[model samples]
Target: MAKPKLPIPVTLLTGYLGSGKTTLINHVLSNQEGYKCAVIVNDIGEVNIDAELIQKTGVVTQKDDNLVPLSNGCICCTLKVDLINQIAELVKSGKFDYILIEASGICEPLPIAQSIAVLEGDEEEGTPAICRLDNIVTVVDALRMATEFGCGDNLLKDDVDEEDIESLVIQQIEFCSTIILNKVDMVNEEQLGRVKAMIKTLQPKAKIIEANYGKVSVGDILNTNLYNFEETAGSAGWAQAYDKDEDERNEHHDHDEDEHEHHHHHDEDKHEHHHHHHHDGEDHSNCDHEHGHCCHHHHHGDDDEEYGIGTFVYHSRRPFNQEKLQEFVNNWPKGVVRAKGILWFSDKDKRDYLYVFEQAGVQITATENGKWLAAFPKSEQKKYFKEYPDIEEHWDEKYGDREIKLVFIGQHMDKPNIIERLDNCLDD
Candidate 1:
């Protein structure tokens, strides 16, 4: 009756080119805060170059320090064949407490997940997994999402063929468990709102964190232990991957009822339990691909077409009635697959602190963030605004960055009503 040993967290960082994956990697390595961390650069040539840059931060080099560079970095080269073996080698080294796998810009991240998915499951609850897949963090450049990764509102634009790189970008967004909307500073408010809305349509299940230059709190990305095999495999492109496998493992049992019950699973299921929206659990049992169902995975064909979806942004300087805000969050109207930003409450206790808001579904939870810049004296304001100049755009000389700014996305969202409801909550 031995308890399973804790599985070390293995985080996979995926993003398109110039999406700030390396920056985030550098940040993690530079500010490891004494964690015996190991960085595994799986991309072909980028790892060497990126490693050099990371070393420039004055952190010891992995070659002489804490990094491991792997070959076959090209997408065309060997992929799944030796990836697991390489991971096993790192695990055996026993030199690190946490391991980070950075996916090349071109490679699909799901295959990387399945390579580890075989290890996580409730059936193996008593037996520790080789490594727990902590999170599939995708660093999306907000500016690029609009200009480069033209992901419209549609999650499955299967009717239209897609170009190679464009499709890959969309797939990466859809497959992640948490998405870092990096490079937020590069875009204007209008562009930022559109990009967030587009992302919501593409991957409503992924928890979105608005980040600038990958300057996200380390606690948000690593060691959170929020990865759930059953729940995570619900994104549009990778939904039902593990569940389909689980059903096969239990063939003798009557999985038919359970299968049918969730066969038409909606986005609400994924968000109901957590922020990320769930996909329809349609059975692709007929898929014959060697690596589970291939229907949802993108092949990135030549005829990629842009999706046409709506986006809405609400920026208000007034503080909200705490009761009204909470009530609206509890029973908000349908739609708004993704809603996230900062909230300002009128209540004395709540007003002093910035309330961080992120929602995958109807359920929205507001947690206390650090104080608003307005709370600090004018002389000390530069220290706060130095990192986020964008905050200064909306900063009131008297109020500072104290406002309820939320970006919401849905199918032809009732933007006006949503705006009105929020405005109604404001104190006179």
Candidate 2:
């Protein structure tokens, strides 16, 4: 006889460095109901604030403590084996109904998920039941995310890569079902709008919540099932809008790209062409991109300097020239801190395409695009391709794929110059 499968909901709490993940988890543990919770807090250095906070919740702890701590700090690659063993022990004890794993700020959730996805009954003893992943709620520092798009100061290591920080933040947000934008009190009303808009651009499906010192409701952050593999690959806001079924959306995006390209060319003719266009929009009267002064009124640089943080979207209908794009990416200007989005290159060996996120002048790999053959199951592909067949007869005939889409974030940089360099890389 086999044991019944239990609904073991596991919530993953994660965020960037100094984003107050521990503080949010402490509040969850204190306010949880209708479940016996087992928390596994993975800490990087000496401080285990999440573990300490959960322990103070007066829940029953297994011997050697239920809080499995991985002090080595590389959870993305090395912590899976220990995590599986601890989960097995806890399930066997039958003392917990739900589980929560507080991932280290720098860790990626893919490997941890892969470990849980492969769990089997033979590896365990008493309770050999299937465990389900529930919610992944990311806690964000509103103030920090406003000023710093992706890069963070690493006080621990001397040579910390800023590229790694951007990649990690994007990965965490992409996989999570909900994102909690904590530390709201530190930012003003205008700043809050900017943060929300930025987050909406990065992750459209996520439900963003504002909190100060972990004041968010635990119920809202839990129980969401948002872990589909295909959707996760194209989960960003811009990507989602680009991925819809309607031909009208595609045409609209294409028209938008054409308009943007026209503007880029017009701006190149004379710098005064974009003199009045604000960073957010043209409607705001006080804003001006010509002077490098934003309406946020943060007082960035001196009178002679132009230093304000901003983001913009770039879209292309054709693939890039690989060598030219590489040169452009490597030689980014000084004020530009981060630029990320998907790119299609004609010279790349891999057909699936690539995702690039540049931070502090380093480009880090996010993932390869979805496989053309795997897009639809064999049975469905036969039926679907009949109506909308690819006339190009591509190597992978069934799936339709196209060009570069990027989002640029910079501080006090010349937008016209940036757009010009990037446009030269794309095939005309």
Candidate 3:
């Protein structure tokens, strides 16, 4: 019997806007090093300038079948289906040994990785399951590292609804297996070291490679076979922090149960005393037992704390006064690295619209996501409740599903002060 054909290895390249993804792609195409790589370029605009630039290099022509351009949306969100279909077509052709995908700067790597993992081929349909993700490579601008992450500049000047660039950049950094720290020549050694330290804190598992003008060893990125869906998904610092928090909570709960049972067997009075102690242990300032809300403060050890790097989640059911909220975000906050979450506003015009707010360094952006479930007809809302039972469990009669849930990550952030300030903005 004939052996099954091996799947083609695919490498996903992602970075923040203006991080030189196109430059790196040009470098790869210019020096194939005996590998036939099919390149898929994705851009946010209608015109794919990246594709055109690659054509100008004369490494690949406009008519080259290996070059595929996807535009108008990001592959991680709106263009997911399109990306899958494109990959399917590319795999069907059997023309290349490897595939290179240039994800849009704002694209999140997790969803794209997830989509590729589940893609199966049907022999009857003439599409074979002949693609395996090799690795995820993220490029970072060494010079802009401090300014872009620290400043409050909006990533996209025209699109208010675009995802916050700073949050997206951090997300891109956290999820990748390899980081190309490009333009090392632009910064001093101290600045470069700081950039490397920040990247290491965000993602310790990813290997960082310093490069100048998007130049790197071609073998370092291609066919590395480092992409493991499960490992990559959980590799982010934020994800690990959440998982650790959950585990600690479970362990505490289990210990309390054991203590209660032992006390009950010995004496009823002792049982009550132990129960009181358990409640005392549970009364942490960062947690709201009554509301079942927890502001998880991730402890990344003493060294990490010295760097002041930490993360916390802010959740509230009340809507915010639009004017006050805007003013608060405009000022932004010092020492706060990144913040992103869904928001609820009390303004009459925006009351029904759910908003998403993002902040990185000094830059922040808020955009109308869509109507809240409460804004829908009662019957329509009931349908959503039926589909997601948990939605109804958390529903407030006055506010329904509208709530504020923001995650803030940074160095030496005053969590209590920030939370109090946000509370002041609430339209109570």
Ranking by lDDT: 3, 1, 2
lDDT of 2: 0.56
* Residue pairs with backbone atoms closer than 3 Å in model 2 (clashes): none
lDDT tens string, model 3, 111-157? 88877765644577777666888889999999888555544454553
Off by over 4 Å in 2: 1-5, 46-50, 60-65, 120-129, 150-163, 225-233, 244-323, 333-388, 391-419, 426-428
lDDT of 2 by residue, 109-183 (tens): 766766665553334555454576677778888887666653333223333443356556766765666788888
Output the worst ten-in-a-row residue range by lDDT, candidate 2.
Answer: 263-272
**lDDT for each candidate structure:** 0.59, 0.56, 0.71
Off by over 4 Å in 3: 1-5, 77-81, 118-128, 157-163, 252-307, 312-333, 339-407, 419-428
- Model 3 steric clash total: 6
Q: What's the lDDT for candidate 1?
A: 0.59
lDDT, residue 31, candidate 1: 80
lDDT of 1 at 407: 47
Better of 2 and 3 by lDDT: 3
Supply the global lDDT for candidate 3.
Answer: 0.71
